[model samples]
Target chain A: MATNIAKIACAVAFAAGVAAPVTAAAKSSTVTAIEERGTLLCSGHNGSYFGFVEVNDKNEWKGLDIDMCRALTTAILGDPDKAQIVPLSWAQRFPALQSGDVDVIIKATGWTMGRDTEVGLQFSLPYFFGGTQFMAHGDLGITEAKELDGGTICVEAGTTIERLAGNYLKTLGIEHTMVSYEKASELRAAYLANRCDAFAAWGPFLAVLRATELEKPDAHIILSDQLSNEPIAAAMRQGDEEFVDMVNWMIAALLIAEEEGVTSANVEEMASNPPNPKIARLLGVDPGMGERLGIRDTWAKEMIAATGNFGEIYDRNLGEGSPYKLERGLNNLWSHGGVLYAPILD
Target chain B: MDAAALKLRRSRRDMLVQTLLVVFVVLVIWVAISTAHTNLTELNMTSGFGFLERATGWSYSFSLIDRSIDDSYSKTLLIGFLNTLFLGLICIVLSTILGFAIGTARDARQLGLNSLATVYIQIFRNLPLILQLVFWYAVLIHMPGPRQAFTMGEVAFLSNRGLMLPGFNVSPTVVLAMFAAVVLLAVVIFRQKSLQPVQKLLLWLVSGSGAMLLLAWIFAPADSSIFSIPAQQGLRFRGGIGVPIELVAMILAITLYGSAYIAEVVRGGLNEVPSGLTEAGKALGLSSRAIWFHVKVPMALRTIMPPLGNQWIFIMKATTLGVAIGFSDLFYIVSTSITQSGQTLELMGLLMLSFLLINYSLAQLVNFMNARLALKGH
Candidate 1:
């Protein structure tokens, strides 16, 4: 009798184990999951990436990436406050997303072919454009990156900047050593301590550091050469076409809103009295855009009202409205001599 | 029932139970692999060891082997393993010596010395190792830069970059001769009682030849100078062996932390030694020094070996703290590989296997030493 009961228990456990993955696979979309959980998990930087992702004096997250995460959360769950930021290191971001620790990776992640194909990440449309550059001490008397020979260069590990810097140096036939740290804070510390001759990182981040973190800002010189132009985007796990499309269009709505002269303050006015069909459709006055994407018809309006348009976000975090006061450069609108454009929303 | 019949039935039951256990474990493993495979396929990620052959377009700060952006992942990982092994071995040797000294000092008759040893152990052993590592790293990097390096008679330079020492330009033949001299010295020391007269004479000849080769290499003509002193060039010191600051900081932290633990192990082992044996040695007219070395240490070693082995393994594992300081050790390399190659499972498996092989060898060595030092029966 005991043997029979043991056999039955073992059989039941085996059956349950076999059924688990199948049930997990049958789940339809990430949107439903977010709705059920009532919070949208978005990735944030482990340390401050000033102007992109950092805390303010008030101890609140305020940056371009943080605004993007809030916009995504608002679009999905209709409340920006429902966003939960999960801080992750550069190496931990991919694994965190793959293991379902976060819903979307809105960190300042570069879209590379290796990350796209090999790492199994599905990226949304490019939201920000930037370039990689090097910063060196003024005492080195070196003006160009090519002059940094037989010196050590510090960079953040598990980043595209590390690879780009190495490749660029090798292409110029310059010999140097590369040291990488896992956190931006550690990299900054090493560079400041003069442990390495030069530091390599994203261009805007280098500028921000020079302006804010450095006591003697003129003591360091950012080299003029652009190593590589990176298209920064949001990454999610693959095999969810509906979720990917929603995120992609959510980014498009922001750009279109910016181009159509719609601000967070004027979004409600524009929706109530849109002069053209494009603005009407974008603000959900026509109602088909949101239904097709499996969301409320006023999703775009809610998202814009929560996190303003793309231009406002750029200005508030990184451009004239912030301490960095950086130029838009390649991040400007397509009509204004930039590469960013959204497809026509019909 | 007969006793033999009952024994046979019990053996049959044991066999059946063992078979069931094996089957259950195998089934569980199979289920796990299948699930993982299915999930990976759905995510469009490949899972295999094939990614090891792909080019790793990154560079490490310090590597024993020649590496480049074009090198394959396998080569990079091998260099990382070598770096870790080298660091672990150096720390093990230094900590053992330091631990023995401190442990002996702890048992000293002098109160001040004993208290000093006690304080050192308490401070280092109680502090977290990661904090210690970060502290040492901060101290090292805060030193003066290369241009203002603290020079040791211009032969060696200490700077935030590293301790740059004057390197030798010896030929391969000189290195080979030096190796041969060490091997011959070991043979002479280990087999002195059993060596024939002719063998001893041959050993002497080899040692003499090795010494002559080294002297010749050292005194080669002025144009072919054997010493390469570090001199400031461009952004750093050139023409000498440059040891990066990361390696120095990692070794210092691991050695200090590991020594504290090992000192305690030594103290326990020595305390547990039978005091009657020391009294016996004294009664036999042994001198104080002779009694301490010949009576106390050997007996303590038998008890010390097992725990000392554990400390050695722990020290090796602690080398992973290299990542915190950006020392390009095996764990750091494998983690970077996971991000670059996206073969997380395979890379992680490789890392675990490599560490297991390393620590297992260390454990076996400890066991062998314990056996050799153990008390023997008549």
Candidate 2:
């Protein structure tokens, strides 16, 4: 008789435990919770993704994605080191965001119509533009993707590149088989071991892989054909327009800083001695932008001082300052031949 | 113990407790549904199985059934499910046979065989399954390409692309003859109650050999060939069974890895069988083979059944790791679909249902075996 009463009590307790979280989540905003926690939880790649997200020799996270997380955290909390990156597989990233396990996803996530409309997440503006391409051993003498006909291509599974490469090969009338791996490192290992004739991935990512991870960079070359556009962006949980606006404006601030010739080293000097009205407003010398976004006036200035302008961040992680040595082709400012442009900092 | 006494002793506390338990369960379920509804509504997404009818624009390299890129998502999932079942069933059969062999070898008196079995168990058992899978896959991938593949006298080929083996396209006559032979064998076996054991055996062998000869006679291309060997055509092998290297690697890793644990179980079962039973069999004037078949095996099997069934279940679960090596098992396909469609919750539900069905069937089968083998009184 007593055991029956105990069972009833246990059931009631379990029910209460299950129902408590819903009420708690309903009461507080996710942004406020992140702010209170002080650390900006970010989802990124588990395996080294070359210039995007990887562990350095010192075991510290160092990459373009990590810098983006730092920039977002600095804009929000006025501190860059408060950013914490949680590495996740490509399949786990969206689920992790939806479950609120991470505050934002600074992984090199591509923005797509299906993803935006179907998945319960919103993407910020495109921070980087890349396209699907192929890389093969230089000894193969294959200059283009069409040359990989009737050959196997190695790709990463559960990624856009897999679909892109598959579709592209179909269009090229090639009867090819794809062996996709779950992890980036495994894909590279299989390709390097000559298991696959070509490796399909984004152009910049392939460049990073070749320049940084390969035994000999000159031994392989990425094909110049751009099969599909991949506008990479940061993702955040939906239903928080404020948080979305905050992240979007943070990315825009970097582009605007590049336009205004603001570097991490020169941000403080530029803020103190404004060369133009737009620069004055951008550095928060004259407030209004951050107030509208429900953040502090010094948000852009803090972000710039921490991670530098878009050009500087690109150069440091994926361009001349890094081993990838990628030029700012399509990623350059709009005034140049490239298409990267920021809205006027009114 | 009487029903009247039980009814008279029913307390109000028991009734209240039962009520509370039901209420709690209902409340928990209610909360879960409402929360999911709220989240889906906020996301502006519809929840249902309507997406199953949509065409899967992607193509899979390997499928157990005939499928194309234009197939529906439901068909894709079914193919993935079948592939997973195929791998699981193959691994289970292979591992069981290998485990029994190794287990018997371990129990044997010879030091060389025993040491070899022990070394195999130790090595496979120590390494992680995923790491082993990746390693095997890497080895296969690094093998020579199609032009320089290792071949078996033009009958079979092994390359980094895959292994190709001679496949059969049985003629109508061969199929009819095989069916007729099976019926004939059944009839002969049924009528064998009046015949001597040697006569029965002779009848079986003649029928089997006749069936084989009939099939062999139909092998030539009078109308169409019964068997055809694979031949290289351009960059691909044509007219043969092409097994992907991914599948080979997955199966090899799962079988070899699962056999290690199953071997240990077999060894433990063998050790648990008392020597006194064998002594008793011998005292009863039973031969050594009779003692082993009657006493040792039955005794060992009674102990081995539960753990062996558990190992089988473990193997099925391990087939999910096939995703690492690009074998399009159910989990891998569902995960890829979720990534493409962004229907995590719905696809996860489907995945859970698939695994649950498989596990439930295995559990039922195991329970039935256990009941059949159970001691009479127990």
Candidate 3:
């Protein structure tokens, strides 16, 4: 009887210990440090890969990640000026975060296992979803990435693109050589020099490169086939649950903005009026919604005013207004049959 | 009556020496580790070595190993270590040669040669090594495409991507012949060492090496057929050696930077040697070159060994600049390893340890050389 009771006790103890993790998992996510600092610290790339991250004539960073930072800043501080963007290369991004150099990283990073389990980071939510693709100079008549058998490729160092490209080549049983350089500039130099048969990179980047950097934009074409589906997100150090939630909700808000008719031009008027109870709540026409997120009722309104609506942001940073000229495909609202779908506002 | 005096006498010397010894030990360790440990852990991160086993599923643009991102971070690090070693060995040999030329030129009487030496040293020394690296990379990477690549006699090729040339693709017959050549060279060197004078032995070695190389070229049989990438196509290249521009830049930086300082050291060492030593040798009917070689430089070697070793540590540390060009040397690979493993502290420690090992080994080598070559009476 004593042994059985002890056994039962041990089982109960094990169950309790296992169940204890629920609170621990929920506890580390406080965005208080970010709120106190009054700025969203974001680390991004230095290059003008175009539409992604680039420095303007004044030498300030501006791009998709920059816009996201603006949106989050407006959400938290009721002012867009509360966001600071720190530039880092592929090698510098993680160390900066691990050392508290930056609050979060929204650089062009793929959500990988090592980054999560090994690095002790929380990848809050994927903002931009895409994959690796290859592009060849049109004159080579290399229609497919597979057609470049025994050809050479140029890629940047500290990226997953090289591995992905190699995997595809291996699958097709084609012989190829991959040359890498430390910076994007070096890779681009090699590409322009005609050292590589193809330049392998992300889809959006290829489009941006063609639009902006090329001497003749139409001289090259990106292969339609994607080698990998990368779900990139804003990342922060583990144990900052509140900050993670804030960034996660910020990404969801972008989808919600698309779902609603809240363009940057029309957001002010819409916030004043009411199409639905949800928009009023989201725009803080109602009082309770903003409090739940630990912000002022005018938080959404300020965010919209600072960076424009989701549609405006996309258009400005990556769409028709920007040089990339990308169409909103799966990134559109669920009602429009794209991948973006945010939950209904409470 | 004498007890107090004795106590005072012992303590003043003992306590001071003890204190000095403790301070030295503590300070050395503190300087070695405190910064890396403190800066890394403050952000809720811990340092340790658990990251070596985790999967790294990425591929490098330039790799010595068949690494995929799927391989362990440890593998990438190993590959990077090998690259650094190859670069270090090459730069050491090249800088030694360049240093000799520069040191010789500095005091030379020939007006044109002196001016050229001065120009070479000024140009290379004035430019930052990293800037030089970037410049070299820029020149190489921005060149026109392969079809438009500069070609020499339809054999050597250069393009922005990388240079491709005819490499010896080795067959089994070539391997056997290489082994035979190695054995023959070894036998020749052994005979020269055992039976001949030093000068005569050196002559024998040069001839032996030349004959072996000639035979290998003839028997190893490089394909005069269509050229391939300078690196081996399937595995590693046997005959065709490709020095990638990234590697070229790093070597250039390390060698050019290191050689300038070495030249200064050599000059200083030579100046310290008594002029009478050479005059004595000449009086004894020894040649001027032989007098300088057999007596002066050997003595100078002892005086300069420690500083040379210190420069080597700097060279090893400066190799971290390879990160800029993506050569994946110790620093570059360590950073990537940190990124993949999330074991930042452990990997950082590992990196420091690796550098410590490299520095320690180089120091040991210099110390050994200094000890063996130290003057007998001193």
Best by DockQ: 1
DockQ score of the complex predicted as candidate 1: 0.59
Candidate 3 DockQ, CA atoms:
0.22
Structural similarity to truth (TM-score) of each candidate: 0.68, 0.62, 0.61
Off by over 4 Å in 1: A1-129, A231-346, B170-184, B193-223
Instruction: Give the DockQ ranking, best first.
Output: 1, 2, 3
| Residues forming the 10-long window of minimal summed lDDT in candidate 2 chain B | B167-176
Candidate 2 or 3, higher lDDT? 2
Report the lDDT tens digits of candidate 1 across residue range B73-125. Answer: 99999988988998999999999999998998898789999999999999999
- lDDT value, residue A112 of candidate 2: 82
**Model 1: CAPRI class:** medium
DockQ of each: 0.59, 0.29, 0.22
Question: Whose lDDT is greatest here?
Answer: 1
Give the candidates in order of lDDT, highest first: 1, 2, 3
lDDT of 3 at A295: 59
Error of 2 at B116 (Å): 3.0
Q: List ranges where model 3 is wrong by over 4 Å.
A: A1-129, A150-156, A159-182, A194-197, A230-346, B1-48, B163-239, B281-288
| TM, chain A, every candidate | 0.73, 0.74, 0.74
